[model samples]
Target chain A: MRRWLARVGALTAAAVLIAATAPIIMADDLTVTRGAGDGGVAREREIRDIKSEIHRLEQRVDQLENENGQLKKSNAELKQNADKLQTSTTQQLSEIQSRASAPPSPADFMDAMNRFLGRYRFTLVGGAAGSYIYDRKSNTNTFALDLEPIILWQLSDKLLFEGTIEANLPAGSSADYQLPVADFQYFLNDYAELVMGIFDQPFGDWYEDQSPFWVNRFITAPLPYNVGSLIPPTEVGLQLRGGFQWGEMGQVADYTIWSGNGPGYTNATCGSNTPPSPLPDCSTTTALVGDTLVSDNNIRLNTHSPGFGGRFRVYPLPADSNFGRLELGASTFDGKWLDGFWLTSWGVDFNYFRDNLQARGEWIQTYRQMPQGLGADNRQGWYVQAGYFLTGLQVPLLPSELDQYIDRLEPLIRYSGINQRATVLGNVITTPGIGFTGSPALYAPHAREVAVGLDYWFAPSIVWQNELDLELPRAGGFYSDTGQAVGAYPNDRAFVSQFAVGF
Target chain B: MSRLIKFGMMAALAAIALVPLAPRHARAAEMTPAQQKRQMFRRGAQLWPIYCNTCHNARPGGEFSPTEWNMIIMHMRTQANLPPQDANAILEYLKASR
Candidate 1:
């Protein structure tokens, strides 16, 4: 704007010069044509007239220049105002956007409650499972259903809470109940942690999230971890665990240890002596009465026991795309039976996973020293299972197929074995109130079985599992609910189906 | 002399109780993904009693970022219903770790 005004001023001065000179040149041309029409006095008068006209033009230019200067000042102010407004608008827009999207930090936790000023989470996990088991006493097939509803929430970072409500669909029996497995862990670093409340004591590969059916080629968790009735899981207490990453040592090597209230598995047993070999409820009174078969801790050790367990894992060729994981773990529980005598159970477990071809198995032995006259019960069992995904088993599917049912469909088979001497694995204690004492032997009559399952993960969050199981009895392999050496081994066949969601 | 004696006693207590805590506080430790993730939120939610579990019921998605949520929760940690770590885990679990 300032420069424009300067140009206007220069143009005005030049126009005045031209206007004043043009008349003189015209007068000279006239004098040449009129042949000296007037003397010096008339020529001089014409020149003065031209000068007067130039003066009037100069006055007009001065007036125009003053008006033009005022106009430029106004234009400059308007431009300045416009620029300021644009800057203000841009700043306001950025402020609004910043308030809308990004979390207050480099990392953010957002869910329904995250939007609000509190910690919150809502989860619903409802699924059904059917199991087919062959019982030697009934010599018939038995089918049962398992339905579970899951709710997990976080009120803050240091705390976590999860509740699972389970029920049997058809009967809607009292089998359904709510259990809270909430924990608060203190983080010392990225690798070590301390936890309190009810949580799984990290014992071995099987005790963690490793599902017998989903991992590598194994169709089942090995004998030692599952049956020792020993590897206590999900306890209510405190746990201290740390993970060490040794780049110079190996690619994937981790260790975890936990010491807490060692609780047995769902409806499981933690017995040192025979839980008074639960009598065969084969009796007609299936309806549970008031505490006739209540658990009688035969040993002096209280039902609430103290135990510590750990797992060590090593990955061979860690940096390589194709590698294997070798894990070895062990656990022990010392508790008494109803008779109040000390009894101890200890077991070792192992599992190996390599790509799609995976194999896992564990061997565990349980010994029972009966109080007074009753002979000591000593037994151990182990099962090794290997499975391969027929469809490039280990390799994850393409991006598009990730959520489809076909991606989860894999054919798997596994085999497990047990020692008859380890009667605890096969014996079922009849809890007068809870029905069957969660002894493994009563639910499983045969010592060994080969199971093949067809699995389909319908979606990343939903899994549909089906397994056809074949239990073969060795020539002498046979036991009744009484733990009696039965006449001969009888085989059982059935199919089991399950659904699970992780969200 | 009595004030000096009191200071000495206090200093002695501090020296004894703070020895183990000093190392852990000065240096942050490393943890497994599950542990790293599962533990920090636990420590962060130490405030819940005075903040949550009053009239605003904890449904599904209740409140706060894992970081900010920790602040609101640390204020209410001691309540029996909303223990610090337990409350924090409930919130962190709902929020995506990513």
Candidate 2:
């Protein structure tokens, strides 16, 4: 602006000098003409012409001054505009920094609360399941619904509380509600924690870690971990649990030790041993009372002794390694039956996980002393499963959008077998006045199953699952909706479908 | 001198107990960038057992790049109802470790 003003001032000065000198130069020309003996008429005309020229120069100077004033005004306006723009830019930058440094807004806090706060989380899983089964007598299709609502509260960095509520609708039965787990864990350090309340039986990967509807690949659990498989699923207990980190690996070991209400049995035995082969001669030995059945240990029948259990896990690879994480686990439980007999269960499991692949296998055995002279019931089962993500293989024909959707799809296959030897006692009746003593052999019959399934995850916690199960060798009965034997079936092949969601 | 040492030890224990009780994400407000990064790593470590281990064994951090982690977390956030800020923390942790 200053440079422009300097130029304008120089031009204005030059115009003024020209305007002041033009008339004198014209007058001198007229005088020279007169000295050369010019006419008076011509001199007058020259004078008039000089006056007109001077007037024109003056007018030109005035126009230049007007232009200079306009230029000054425009420069001032431009300067004002520049100042406003700089102020606006500074304010915008300050606003951005303030936003960056500010704490979470009210809306964000509210959203966190709605999503179960930063310290708390809630997940609702399970779904409606339908099944079609082919039995020896007939073919039947059935539907059932199940719900598991899970809530977790992180009280502090070291303290956490979790609860799971389950409601199940069994085929041909009313709905059953259960508090499967409600526990609080207090971290002692990075290595251990104290857990109290009703918790999942920490016997294997299926019981404590991978049993949720959204997590597991298959719709139904294997025989060993399913209902009435003789393996306890949950218990009211106190536990000490922890994991260890070794070297640069993520986690080397995980362990849990717990004590809870011991297991019990019902109608085990009631008669004295006799010398006769049929054992109906009631004169030789003391009478044996039958064991009471207590699948759940909510009410302790034996106050003096509590069930003791433990699980130990070893991870061979780093927990976060991209190749895969492999884990081996062993678990055991020891308790006294309600009939005062001893019971014990033990299991071993292996799990391998990678971004595109997962494989798990488990073997569990349960033993209980017979109330009568019959030998103890030894029941055991083992299952191996594998799931592969189709997208991980990078099939060429798949489009990008299809690939994303397919990435969430996992196809799985499992093979499992259960063997049981506890049917004899159920055939012999010991109580008086009750005439019926039917064999329950079908309840825990021996069988092998090959299952194929697909899990399509809508989200991390939501899945649509469909599976077909083939149980061979014409078992005593088929497993019902609750995974327990109910009606009669020679051989069973079932198609099961479920829609599951979490959170 | 012995008494002073005992008092100092007691105070130190108290601090340890109190420190973890603060909101982990909120505590990052006054921290430097490096400190915040470290805190995110710690938070991700803690969250692995709580959330990831519930369904499946947690994947190792070396399994994916920062970009992959970001995509994976975004997918999980929707499924798990994880807050954006918490998701970012986990993402930062994975990226930093990677």
Candidate 3:
């Protein structure tokens, strides 16, 4: 060990800083056009404080660099002293060596802290993806790509600050764009937390886990996850949540709750029923209306009500050998964007993994409420999917002949459904429907699709995903433009093939 | 203060390395669902090393909510291009820690 220590070299200042503060202390990569409240003064002061802290941290890093070299030597010395102080372990041995006894020493104490220790880390993510699509109905084949990267700084054991930017070229259709999601988090006693900055809108499970491309079997989360993408999943605001576990039906259970921005997407739907654009900009009326904000989308587009919701996911299949992994969950919200809208939802996800096969199924129900005459559209929707893996896999090169030629391969098939009311798409009149009070031009995009997919994972990081899109027959009408003559489903069939790595 | 600084540096490194290893520890133990939910603090603290340990401090029950933590994971997923499942795992880990 001493020989290994002697061969080491001095580490860089950047490396030391990266080590001392958990690398995340300085990796924010987002900048925006918005200014802080009370003008730029607050921002200026904050900048000043950060600069001072950076200096202090750097100095501390330099000192730690010196101490790291001593840790090994110190440990060795302590171990030696402990050895010198001890002669034998058992009573029989101690009796034979009476003079070998030594007083309790702090030698062991120093080493104990070394074991109960933590670590620091910093990560940088930058990626690019090009989408090439050929749609027979639209008679179009298009290719586009997007690039963005993120950096995060873990300041302490319980503090985190992160920054992100989205850069796409040529806007929405062109695949050219840029957006930033930056925030600071303070874990207030573990279960309780406080966060302020741009964040994802939390309507369901899909939106929160929309990336890596490895977790899912498709292009993205369901459209309803963010109200048809009309609303930015990330909003600026503060959120609070905390929950714990208990016993239920002979299994483990979990629950969580949150509050932030709730009424942003309502304005888009409320516009059709209101005079023009009527945002739910009544932050003060949350108690009156009983709405809370879980994610802030901004005042310009928000209905101004806070968003609040709770969730519970439990495992209750009685621990079957190879047939059961089931979880049931429910989340509900009451928010006012244009007029005031409500959503109550519940879902179930089931998984059964046995031997060389896996199966999964899920269903969700969302009940919505609007004003009697203005925002008068009420609706619910859901879907289900199941799949299985055929191949029994093992490493090919580790002295096993059966693994080399095959690598890895599996085929899958699936079908799903959805139903929605036309009012959700920004249709419907004020007196006849629950309308949009913030923006009149707003409308909703509603439809359903059933897709069959084939995916193959050759290596752990290498995969081939291919899917055929089949439209489901389902729709509702609110007005003439949105009421175009059509069948139960209008989405044409399309195929998607994707190759990705690093999750 | 100096000792605290030393602790900060070494602790930061150990925490950083914990990010990847976090998934391994991401499992929130077999506490009752109620304890798991209330273990927000304990779980949050536990999560400090696995999920946030890479770039943030190991403040465990220190900052953020299970939901807020979920949102952050979402942002990082889209912004940093993290895969959906990994994002979910991180979310689950962060949530449990909270």
Clashes of each: 80, 13, 125
Please give the TM-score that candidate 3 achieves against the real structure: 0.51
In model 1 chain A, which range of ten residues has the least summed lDDT? A287-296
Residue-level lDDT tens digits of model 1 in A1-503? 57756766776777877777886767785775677655655766867786687687678767777987899899999999999999999999999899788665434334433567453344443344544444343344444555555444554444445454545532213464434245564544434445666654454444444431222222234434333333344555665444333442223344444444433222223222223333332323221101111122112223445544444444444323244545555544444433344335555666555545556666665555543243555555566666554444334554645444344566767766555432332333322111111113322322565667676655433456565555566513223233344323346554445554433
**Docking quality tier of model 1:** incorrect
Give me the displacement of residue A37 in model 3, in angstroms: 99
Q: Against the true structure, what is every candidate's RMSD?
A: 14.4, 14.0, 32.6
**Positional deviation of residue A369's Cα in model 3 after best superposition, in angstroms:** 4.6
Model 2 Cα RMSD, Å? Answer: 14.0
Chain B, TM-score, each prediction?
0.34, 0.64, 0.40
* Per-prediction TM-score to the true structure, in the order listed: 0.54, 0.61, 0.51
Poorest stretch of ten by lDDT in candidate 2 chain A: A431-440
Q: lDDT scores for all predictions?
A: 0.44, 0.60, 0.43
Number of the candidate with higher TM-score, 1 or 3? 1
Per-residue lDDT over A1-503 for candidate 2, one digit per residue giving the tens place of the 0 to 100 score: 67656765775686687678777867776676667655655766776776776677668667767887998899999999999999999999999999889998644655556567343333332333333322223344556666776655555545666777777665556877778788887766544467898877777877666676666778777756553445667788787665444434344555677788866554333333333222232333322222223445354455336887767677666545666667788877777754466677888999876667778999988777654465566677789999987765577776776777877788999987766642223422221100011011212456677779898876656678887767666454212112224224534566667776644
lDDT of 1: 0.44
Best by TM-score: 2
Which ranges in model 2 have alpha carbons more than 4 Å from their true place?
A1-138, A266-304, A319-323, A392-406, A423-444, A474-488, B1-54, B57-98
lDDT of 3 by residue, A1-503 (tens): 55334433333454455467543433321121153345455545665676676676668656665676698689999998877667434655767576446543333433344345444234454444444444444444444344556556566645677666655442124433334467776555422445566665443444443343443555433323322332235545665433222332213333334455554433332222332222232222122111122222453454446655444444554332234444455444444554545544445544443333444444555544544332433333344544455454565455666554343554555454434443332222111000001011111234455656666665443456665666544432332122333333255665556554422
Comparison by DockQ, 1 against 2, better one: 2
